[model samples]
Target chain A: MQSDLKRIVSKLHSGMRIAVPVDYAGVSMALTRPMIEAGLRDLDLVCVPTGGLQVDMLVGAGCVRSVETSAVSLGEAGGAPRFNAAVKEGSIKVIDATCPAVHAGLIAAQKGSPFLPLRGLIGTDVLANRPDWKVIDNPLSDQKDPVVLIPAIHPDVAIFHAPMADRHGNVWIGRRRELAPMAYAARETYVTVDRIVEGNLLADEMTGAGVLPALYVSAVAEAPKGAWPYGLWGEYPADVDELKRYAAAARTQEGFDAYMSETAQQGEPA
Target chain B: MSNVLPREILITTIARLLEGVRHVAVGASSPMPAAGAMLRRALDENERTVRLSILGSVEHNFFTNGSCELFDSAGQGRIDAFFLGGGQIDGQANVNLVGVGDYPQVKVRWPGSFGSAYLYFVVPKVILFREEHTPRVMVEKVDFVSAPGVSDPEVYRPGGPVALLTGKGLFSFDKTRPGFTLESTHEGESLASIREATGFAFEHADSVPETPAPDAATLELLRTRVLDELEETYPAFAADWRRDLAALSVPA
Candidate 1:
């Protein structure tokens, strides 16, 4: 079903497990800002924390109660002040995970498996914090070698902004194939796109292989300049100036609130 | 000119260490190592000889399957070298990327472990790079081990730490001995400072040499090509470091 920004925000409630694509995937912060501004609280957020803009925005708005991800930061921009502050204040539970573990958990859910066995976490503290994870001797190995297995992660909703989605809801994800597995692992997938193309994205030879079929997409919304501040790979580049401004403005709670208010006002439809 | 920036020194040392490697992958937030890897790629006359997959750079990265692809490639032995750092690193090279004080109730919280636990085992030449060499960072034992430096003899491991380069000095990780041994100190750094700053005990040679600064040719290439390429992924770091170099070059 085609939905508006307000309707999408209305669909989210307190304590829902939501997953977004990693920073490099070109996720638009626009899709998430409304939900946070609407006072969605106590969220179980999942994603490889890209640090500055996306995760920091949600955490700064106090929308997140817990975060399960690898790391969160602004990358070249600087530290994620709000997210770091929230963690230090003990207001949020940070599930310190590795990138592979996040992917493995999603893979398990995608495959309908109870858990997925992974390599390299055998002797690390990542396993220590996670009682849900278990290290057992690899039964498939000829010799004795223990491996860490992570439980499946099926999010309540998977949301992201993409380059384009055709009217038929075929998302042209291109090389960002993580969306496929993420959508498969979640109960439903919602998307915001920069534009809606006229024809089916799957019908075009160049974009056919990159299409995330309508089968997995529950809702599609058109939000131009959707991945602002963050770049939509191939379509545009990250707005470095805005990201720098965000890092500076978000260092304090009052400043963060003001910044959010300003953006929310500017982002509204006249 | 004798006057050289510390980052230049580090980039030079890292480039030398990366010699002969076919492929080197640098993680996000590692501008110095990323620059060093690009420098190595530039020095090679043979085109496409040294492949660098720098995370977050469009031109550098070639992965189609997103972040998970990095781990998959490392497991298949495609990556030759990688860089890792820690909130706490012990004598045995065990890195703690989780947090300090205790688990769940941490006194200090760092951004969670991205891939150190996994990459440390699979990537053959994992270089532990840390700019801060204080006791707080170089600890006796990390409260939590994010990735153990040395694995059991029977473990099927192809990758481990080769060397660790800090701001003050360089230390070699001997596989046979499986502990850090002081190799050399930076130009102005003394053995006393290195010892006092370090929390963990490490073996050192009777006579340690000074880490060589980047030669004039290397500096030129770094200033132009490496810095230019680094701007794409790490614009802030590249710009800031460039400004620092400019300030250092000014006559008093």
Candidate 2:
């Protein structure tokens, strides 16, 4: 399991576009830590719709060159300090997007389509800023009706944490179906799971519905509490106090470095 | 009645606005709106229950397909109402969730636009809720239009801003006029005071009435049931609200 993680982490190179799941759907700190430890640089992060602590930490650590996301916030804890600061400092390129646009782009990639047409974004600065996105009249409508066409987003790797995986490498994502699209659109998908089950997940009718086949999964590693601080659905609740502490500490570069060093020394459990 | 907290008033006001909506969706970090939606559900006297989908809540949210399901549902006109708050909201109702100053090179950065860019165009009732009512937040024109309030006649937009609710007052948006009309001032606010604080010009009657306070029954429901439901998603907000209620009830 450790070897698999090391192999997957070794494959990650600088200037790669990596797709990651949103905060609540299991953000893999296990996978993220290794990438940071490897000192990977100039990575383009695609936050599948939105981001939170994971995106913030990567930006603060200087691992990310650009971020294509709908929003990056700490939710109840407050604004993402590092992401906000980086944006203000112009340290990272922000490919600002709406939630649907991000999803639509990924869907286009999954279907091998060039682009997908989406409603709204007309006459807004979001549309005005993106030269990549084009406005075209609806072919079906007789009258003038316009829609925004979002280009396909293909990522080099898609990574996330999940509750469990079968021995065959099939991941059970349950209702967090967004991970499927991420895996489908990316060239490779790596997962860190809490537990590895003995049975074939796809064979069981109940679990089969939620399973992502091994075909999309390149490798799987057993990393308990991989989403520490951020909670996995039904596994545990988010450690709000710890998140708040991080939020306060990451407000400044010095404080962020201190927090990182302290956590590194502690060697947070997988 | 005098012991009512500011947030309670806002929640009640939101509940009133949410009336008749079959399904309402509340986004992340919006405790007041989430509480308001819950209140609307609790206040439902009809046989049909109001379906509330508060994003980020494990209990309330029904979407099995993840965040994209929300946009998909809204696109199909399944979501009746949604809440959108911005860093800067202009008189024209253009919301800037992006940032202040300039595009890409903004002076003050804000969380990027979430679903507002699309949801505002699809959801029939897009309530503009900003807790602070000041010139900095309520501007003449937003630095960036994360989502537009009104679109061109040729635009296939079935939804837009219906009302603007702030700490000071409640204003209704008229798509035809593409402007705001001050509806009612909250407890301590008057038309003159609202005008002084607001950055842009808005249409208001000579004598605008004060917004009605929640009755005893509504207050009881909010303090107990609404707060109870809110605790699941917003624990801190719920705790703080309870603390505020406790302090307010003490003899002066």
Candidate 3:
């Protein structure tokens, strides 16, 4: 299991763009821990639509060089302290985006298209700041109509956590279908699962609908409670108290370091 | 009538604004809006079915396809109403959820724009809700435009702001005029007070009406059915609201 995790991390290089799913869907804290421990640097992070704790921790740990995201928050806990501070200090680049734009970009990549046309953002700072995004007249409309075009966001690696995976490496993501596009748009996809079931997940028609085929999964590791602190859909609820502590401690760099060190000590072996 | 809390009034007002809507979608971290949508659902249960989709709720959310489906649904004109809050909102209804100061290096950073940019243009009745009514929040112009209130004539925008509700009052937006008009003030607020609190210019009637308080039955429904449903998604907020109501009812 440890070897598999190491092998997955080996493929990751500094300055690589990696994509992760949003918070409500299972986020891979297990995978994130190893990358932070390895002192990975200068990576471009893409939040499929939005992000929360995982993005903040990576920014705090100095592993991210740029964050292309719609939003990064702690939900009920409040604003993401480290991420906000980093952006204020100009330590990292922020490609500010709206939720649909992020999804549109990934969808474009999944379809091998150059860009996808989206409505809204006609006269906004989000569009003004993004030089890569283009506003063009709708060719199909005879009347003057304009739309924004979002370029494809092809990440080098896509990572997330799930309830379970079978021996054939088919991962069951349930209704978290956003992961499918992330997996399809990336060159490689890594997943950490709570457990590996005995039977082939794709063989059963009932479970087959929710399964991501092994063709897109580059590697899978068995790590129980892989999405700790953050909740898995039906597994557990988020640790709000712990998130609050992180939110408070992460307000200062010294406090953040202390929190990180303490967290590192308490981390269980993979 | 005297026992009504300010939040209950806001919830009732929300329900009023949401009347006749087929489907209303509330986003993350908005307990008030969720409560409002639930009240609307409860009110329309016998007469008509008003579908409510509160994001981040397992039971209330109807989307099985994940987060992207919300934006997709709104774009297709399936969602009739939505709620948006901002760190800074101007008279023009421009919202700034990104932060204050310049781009990249901001003095104060709030969360980045979530689904606002797309939903504002797609959701027909986008209600601007902000509990904090002050000069700092009600700015003349936002530091950044996370979502513009109105777009160019050539832009493919099917929706825009219909109203702005705050702790102090409710203001209706006229897209043709591209500005806000003070509709009604809350119990303690007046036209002069609202003008003093607001940073931007807005039209107001000579004698503005006070926002109507929730009636006895409406209050009863809010205290019971609405809070019960809201507790599933916002346990702490529900508990706090109940506690506050309990404290209010005590002899003082």
Candidate 4:
């Protein structure tokens, strides 16, 4: 149960998928690569392409089965969102990122509550349907409406990389963020941080910056350059050479094993 | 340097740009124009119809009523003017967001355009604004053309840039001029200053003119509408307004 990243991930069987709603650049490389090295290379990653970082990494990891976008980027490819050339997989399903949030909001809308704030789907657009986008309510009533039904997101898990955390699992982002709802919605959540700060050091202003209560996070690894080898705020971009290196080795089981073998030979934990 | 009153100079410049307009659009974190427009409204810029559609409305007044949670700023483009930035602007007027380096990645990676991804195509009068105008910021060929001026008229349709606003000057690109054609510079800046700031050397008109300082009416209106009425009303924005001043990271 208390295995390092390698043992826990390499042990996973197939028919599994994971979601990474990360900012762009190759920042989440280190946090994400371990999953592949640990043996979960067939993951269907939900990406944020211009999201300012990591399009190449997800493609390189061979993890992104489908791209999720409402509109295309205005880039060289005419902002047409798609997977890298090498990732020519056709079986993967593409879904909206906001579908999960809309579903949760729909549940809230139906209950006549302020914010349902559920642990169901909050990212991925399984619930974003119709003109309402996610929340479906009676347009019939002006004063009184009955209910709205929002579809729930069914992603198996969510991974969050934060700046700091408390042992109790109170996560803090150090600034305002947009992904908290989705992270809270995942059936399970994993958090990787540069460091776990103590309760006292965190100013009142910095408290409640992250989303967990300790109980929600299934795994919390101290991955210093985890967002690396993508960009972490105060740090440099991920080591591209290292990432390209990973991409070359993680395409197939043999490649992954050979990569593992090489790293192990260098005295890394096997 | 708190969100001091918008200088009379900047206020007039924007007012003139907004003149003869019936409809206008302003995005999040841009209160100065919204405020000026409010003044313009009082001054009867549109006489009867409400002209400006302030979308991506971060100001609290609009958001609180609807539980006001809308995703992304691109959708609210019902107005006239939309603003954008460029990480790498090439000679072809293409903006880059692809990898930073030659084949793969670049040294400087930007947080890709959040909604510029779509706004560049949809919004009609897209105005490009940037605080920094250095070579890396204004280049010859962006590593990746995140969005280019709509040229492939048959298949693709980008809204096409109307004007570029920078700290040094104003530029309106020609259909043929790589990135943009230099139109004019601010009072203090010179052609050399603009060229030095640009990464890919650009072309300029023979006679560039100085931008006129904002008129008094524009100044008074900007003060009352933007600094006075708007900031006071939206307390949630009070902090950001102050932050923009302290950091000078963005236009206040």
Each candidate's lDDT (Cα)? Answer: 0.85, 0.91, 0.91, 0.49
- Residue B47, model 4, lDDT: 58
Residue B22, candidate 4: C-alpha displacement in angstroms: 6.1
Clashing pairs in 1: A51-A72, A51-A73, A52-A73, A52-A74
Error of 2 at B55 (Å): 0.5
lDDT of 4 by residue, B50-148 (tens): 465554233322331111122222234344555666666665556654336642223433333344434455456676766567887788666655566
Candidate 1 TM-score restricted to chain A: 0.95
CAPRI-style grade of the A/B interface in model 1: medium
- Chain A TM-scores, one per candidate? 0.95, 0.97, 0.97, 0.58
Q: Please provide, for model 1 over A1-270, each residue's C-alpha lDDT reduced to its tens digit, 9 standing for 90 to 100.
A: 225877787888899999987777968576777787688889988984333477788898888888888877776676678887888778888888888888899999989999998878777777777889988888988889888889999899988989899888888899888778888998988888888889888887889998889999987888887888888888777787888888899989999998888877676322
User: Candidate 1 local accuracy as lDDT?
Assistant: 0.85
> TM-score of every model?
0.93, 0.97, 0.98, 0.48
Give the backbone clash total of model 2.
0
Rank candidates by TM-score, best first.
3, 2, 1, 4
DockQ, every prediction: 0.64, 0.87, 0.87, 0.05
Write the number of the candidate with greater TM-score, choosing between 1 and 3: 3
Give the DockQ (C-alpha) for candidate 3: 0.87
Give the distance in Å from residue A103's predicted Cα in candidate 1 to where it truly belongs. 0.7
